[model samples]
Target: MSTTGAAPGLSKAFYAIIAGVGGGTGRAVALRFARTYPVALLARGEASYADVVAEITRNGGEAVGVRADVSDEKSLAAALEVVKGKFQGKGLAVGVFNVSSPVSIKPFLETKLKDLDQSLAANARGLYNFAHATLPSLVESVSANPPYPPTLLVTGATAALRGSAGFGVFAAGKFAVRALSQSLAREFGPQGVHVAHVVVDGVIEGPRTKGYIVEGVEDGKLNPAAIAESYWHLHTQHRSAFTHELDLRPYAEKF
Candidate 1:
């Protein structure tokens, strides 16, 4: 990996990893964190993270894109092994779980079990696998005394807090992820790993959301870059001031 323009004072011996590197928040977060640490981008396909990797490299930051399905234990484990090889002796400074399952919006009667299963696999099981793969390295980094606290950030959604009529399955999965994140925070915070969950409660501004209209509210969609910045804040926070959860939404968004 090329470590051309790494942020000043940030240790090159520690790296960040972001899962679910697509064209949205995942890409933005990966780019933002790459400024501080060589990043490992994980996704189910190369097409999802290839452009982001190139963009990072072009900006003189080091990045590697590894195709792995977080919902699959073996796939994620193998991906981590690849990351280990790439970074050599580095430890994990930050880990972001940005994977979200496809939205299944239908009435409860129409929702199939498969939909619930898929969501569970992607949101809950994926995070489980990702945490298992990265937390050990994050813990080990504590002794290395990096510039900032080692962190694990999980991206959640409005569904994580409440279940809408058409969002039961998705909510179930998100809720499970939130619960797990909370548990992890309690268990790992004392170990020097900052585990936090972000509740993204509005439509995010991105290519996939360009056609989405929020009536007369200008700049109604949440900015992925802003979200990434918030994540960086979370990672940099002192252990004594650790934030276990954060909720982000557009100004006009209702609670």
Candidate 2:
């Protein structure tokens, strides 16, 4: 949280990239990491990241926003090329996957195959494309001898742990994301890259959830800034003690 400058001992040639920049956690995370490294914000549209990029620049930090759809391999690859050009010799120090698919809450019988496909494309296939594109750079970064390990932090949801009655479609994709995260952690840990999955278990305080009521509980919704701080912590962890998974929720929320 210190605003002094980038983290101590960090190389100027290392940078961070966050996929899915928006008004909520994505924007918050981008700002948090920007404190320590030049950052690249990726989203499907410029509107999703424009303001966040401006904010970082305003604060004397380096940042760039790119429009890229993680679910589409070609789109994501092209975006990385832009990032490479912008950062030039910088190595990827951190990669955050915060993309989510639109949810269709309905009974299983009423659910359409298209809905399932959409979720899978954004959650599972999206991560697939993202990891393939970033992991090689992450692996290569190990030789850079960064102060912390190269890291990949994934954003998951409550649906990843349980398939609620109306959340079958969402759960199916989140579950795949979790499984993939675990596999990547195991495979990449020995190679000196940190891969972790984070389960965000409560409604986040954001533009979209402003009208939702959590009766009798003041500040019941999760704070996106707080979540971003946790991500910063994860990225700075020592490689000797890597955390493969972390779950976060508000204090008043039920388990």
Candidate 3:
């Protein structure tokens, strides 16, 4: 997947919703977006997320923190309401960034049925509730008098499409999200709503990945800014040339 483009003026994007704000990459992405957009940081860890919200507001941006466990459908619905209330009538929400990961790394043989259910609840079912509930706002934003495009970005991992061992359950849930992106793209692309899946193909720059240049790893590989740029590109692609899948990694990262 190639990275490129900016066919129009930048929208204020008054409302930028980012889930999973406590983790490494999610925080970075949220901060970057908040630099120019009103951001809503959602995570189960409110105590930690509060600091992030303050920093954004202090930097002359608007932000609010909401708590929700992606594993709980009801919790996500309520969280979405909080987001909607925060951005109510702000010309609709310009984006929904699904940064939450539902599964952890575990060998297939050792993975339990319960583990699979847990992963699916957040990765697929949670996403369903997230998008289905937010679509009206997205459509409203795009059809506003002046017009705007709303981006639904699902940040997926390389394992999502590769389906390697030790990642059976995780991969299954990720794959479901991949399917969700493609279907939504087809269903909503023409309506000025862009849905895209981003595959971070290298080790994300995080605590566990620090100082980690392994044979199969790219040190400082998938920086949050790089992934965020892909979101920008996906959102700004021309109507005739929309990119549905974007693969991102450092220049030296291997497949």
lDDT of 3 by residue, 1-255 (tens): 112344233235447778777656677777776765678788887885898898877787788899987667788789878887887767554455465455477877888899888778778886787777666777767766322357777788887788987888888888898898889888988887778788878777776667887555444466776676667666656556777888887877667
Q: How many pairs of residues in model 3 come into backbone collision?
A: 0
Q: Among all windows of ten consecutive residues in candidate 1, which has the lowest summed lDDT?
A: 1-10
* lDDT of every model, 2 decimals: 0.91, 0.91, 0.72
RMSD after Cα superposition, model 3: 3.6
lDDT of 1 by residue, 1-255 (tens): 221233474458889999999987999999999988999999999999999999999998999999999999999999999999999998889999999999889999998899999999999999999999889889999888777888999999999999999999999999999999999999999998899999999989888888786646868889899999999888888888899999999888878
Q: TM-score of the candidate numbered 1? A: 0.96
Ranking by lDDT: 2, 1, 3
- Whole-model alpha-carbon lDDT for candidate 3: 0.72
TM-score per prediction, in order, is: 0.96, 0.96, 0.87
User: lDDT of model 1 at residue 60?
Assistant: 88
